[model samples]
Target: MSATSFAIETRGVTRVFDSRKGFLFREVSRTEALKGVDLAVEQGAIFGLLGPNGAGKTTLTKILSTLLLPTGGRAFVLGHDVVTDAEWLRPRIGLVLGGERGLYNRISGRENLRYFADLYGLPTAERERRIEEILERVDLSSAADRRVEEYSRGMKQKLHLARGILHRPQVLFLDEPTIGLDPKSARETRKLVRSLVADGVTIFLTTHYMFEAEELCPQLAILSKGRIVARDTVARLRQLVGGDRTLEAEAYGFEDSEVSALRRLPGVSKIIEEEYGPRTRLTLRVRTDEIRPDDVRALLPDHPELEVKERRTSLEDVYLDLVEEEAH
Candidate 1:
């Protein structure tokens, strides 16, 4: 697609931060937060950006939202240059970073939306109507009159969403929008995101949750160390694992010797263990073309009962493989 066809575009964009130390805080070194990153987000598409912590997701979002200037290259939102045309661009896009701290604790949710609407220059009558509409859409109408401080984390997150879309922006940037919400709340938020995209709002979402990205975004990019390591549809990304099968087993009272024994299996290439109180979850990677569940079972010393299942490749597997390869 042409550059103008995208709602958000960046070319060789870079951001650098000066690290300082000592009492005077003299500049000691420069760290490259974004290293010539390039991206194109199609209009009305939900594009997911996945990365580990400090991978420059927030930095890129800030530059696109015009909250921070890129040190090199260029970015355009809705065809408006992010740096030079920020005044014209701000009203066309909205940003919702994770956390409830952005809302005013002393004010009602309705009031907070009203304040942002006013900033967007929505007339009195239009502001009231928009506020009501957003509150209903985000399912926060019941809590509109209550002070924000009295609301729960999920409620606060919904309010943040309502505030972001209060002006009906053409593009929206969501940075870990469901970070601290419960499962139900996260599902609700994802539904809202889909509804917004259906209404023609372009969504640029940053998340660490692979399943969430796979469910919401048709296309995604994996960023590692300020650069994109992989970008494609979730299905294509999963193909990076290329025929590798995953064997998952759950058991109680797993000894370290058993884990070591499992690692020695013929086809087992990698083992990841997660402990859930008294139970242990083991995910084993079988590198062969065909998955041999018997191989995994053969290594298990008959002790506590174990439940095992086999599955195809997943986005998490692809992401881990790419990031690990990049590190090497």
Candidate 2:
């Protein structure tokens, strides 16, 4: 693919860290944070990266945003090489890392943004104007003068986003932007993200919230153990894991023969067994309407307490199935 076609692209991008343990006799250990990750994101879109903890989600974000360099392979933002053309990429990209790290607690919200605006080398004449605009955009205008130390968790996160876009970056990297936010704040943050995309900024988001990714990103990649295990739209991902529908059967227990019968039923592609105290839950990935709760009940006649249900396959189901498969 042409480099100019994608807002962000990577080929075999890898990062490894080595650290020594012990005080006197130290032994060096290596951890591979990212391994041969390849990705492509279109401009003016929100691309979601979902992964478990320590799965290199943040590491990839840092590399794409030019904050950390990859140990091997290449990365590009807006067609500029992350390693060789970092200087050119920096001014056009924005990064809002997760948590409370990049802000000064002693300063006001507006002051925090002013500091970042200056660092971004925004046009001297338009610096204050841009800061105000960003604050207003992030809905922090009323709390502009409040010290960051006193700002709520949500407000601080908004300030981080304001600082990130102070220079009007074409591509924004949001690393778990709503990690610690309340439901209402998180909803507002999601709204803000949608607006940013509407304004023509490409967003690279790493989020643990399955619903958030499903809601905001039209395209998604699941990263596990530093590798891209799956990349596709949510609907397609559902099919990859199983199908569009999920059938769940719960009872105290099931005979081996009963499970085999369910597996033999038409449209049943996969069945996952789980034990909960004295009861067991069997989850079936059904691809067709041929299998119903009554059909499952007919197969397991011995269980008097059997309860069967059916629902659409959710993104969480897809994520867990992929990540767990990678783990083994």
Candidate 3:
């Protein structure tokens, strides 16, 4: 689907945290949480907003969910302008803000869903059907009557999640839905999301885990320091950040002196590395236009004993490159 028809679309959407003074008893400060961020999520696609903490994911989500207004730019959710049509837009979207109290501790899971369903104006029969479907889908059927206060963190997260999507919103904004869950629970949650997407539900995900982005989102935007530095599919993004033929490999017993020598080698324009004991794993942005493998081999005459091999680039590598490049 064209991005314009997508469930969520933002154009130069900026959120400036206006400076506010604290009470007379405290000091105050101001910070710009989001800086001219732009993004779009295709209808029915699982789109990811990947960034570290405070990179503006929550700020952006709040703006889109109508919980906060942007200081500048434009944003539309389900074809409704966030600022102008917030009242109408709020019902068509569901949002879960990582871990927060979105439910009543005294309420049972089923009661919670019914409460949300009624709040969303779902008809009685439709509400029953929707609640049943969602409870089963999120695997909460067996404990549907359990009080939320008695639930574990993972269980509570599931309830809040179920409640968010209970009304069958056109857009689901899940901010770290699997944040504190164990590895298995996280995977199961991701799997359920994928199933929902396959059933044509639109999902907007914000996550700190890069692999989660790679797994769930066919389209994604990488936010760095409150701005998008890379946006595309898993493969295209990897290629965008690191062109074809990026040389990456692990080697053992590499000395600090060898790092400098490798930087000077032919076909190597930039040295990307992380130390591993005596060796260093490095990614070299190959300069094939200027120097080929033959050229690199020619330079290796200076260090024939070194262990090195070329390999393809991964999304993790591409992500690091983009973020680090921006930091520089």
Candidate 2 C-alpha RMSD relative to the actual structure: 1.4
Candidate 3 structure quality by residue, lDDT tens digits, 1-328: 1226768888887777756566786655667777888888878999998877778898898999999999888898887788889989778889888574778889798998888898889998788988999989889999999888888888888887898888877888999899999888798899888887877889999988878888888898888777888899988875676454566545554455656776876656577778877766666776455644444444445555445556555667767888777677
Off by over 4 Å in 3: 1-4, 18-22, 25-27, 244-269, 275-280, 285-311
What lDDT, from 0 to 1, does candidate 3 have? 0.79
What's model 3's TM-score? 0.85
Off by over 4 Å in 1: 1-3, 23-25, 247-309
Model 1: colliding residue pairs: none
Which residue pairs in model 2 clash with each other? none
Clashing pairs counted in every model: 0, 0, 0
Candidate 3 clashes between residue pairs 3 or more apart in a chain or in different chains = none
Worst 10 residues of 3 by lDDT: 291-300
> Judged by TM-score relative to the true structure, which candidate is superior, 1 or 2?
2
Q: Each prediction's Cα RMSD?
A: 4.3, 1.4, 3.7
Worst 10 residues of 1 by lDDT: 235-244
Against the true structure, what is each candidate's TM-score?
A: 0.83, 0.97, 0.85
lDDT of each: 0.87, 0.92, 0.79
Residues 204-317, candidate 1: write the lDDT tens digits.
999999999989999999998889998889877755554357888888857788889888776677777889898888888776754466666667757448888898778888
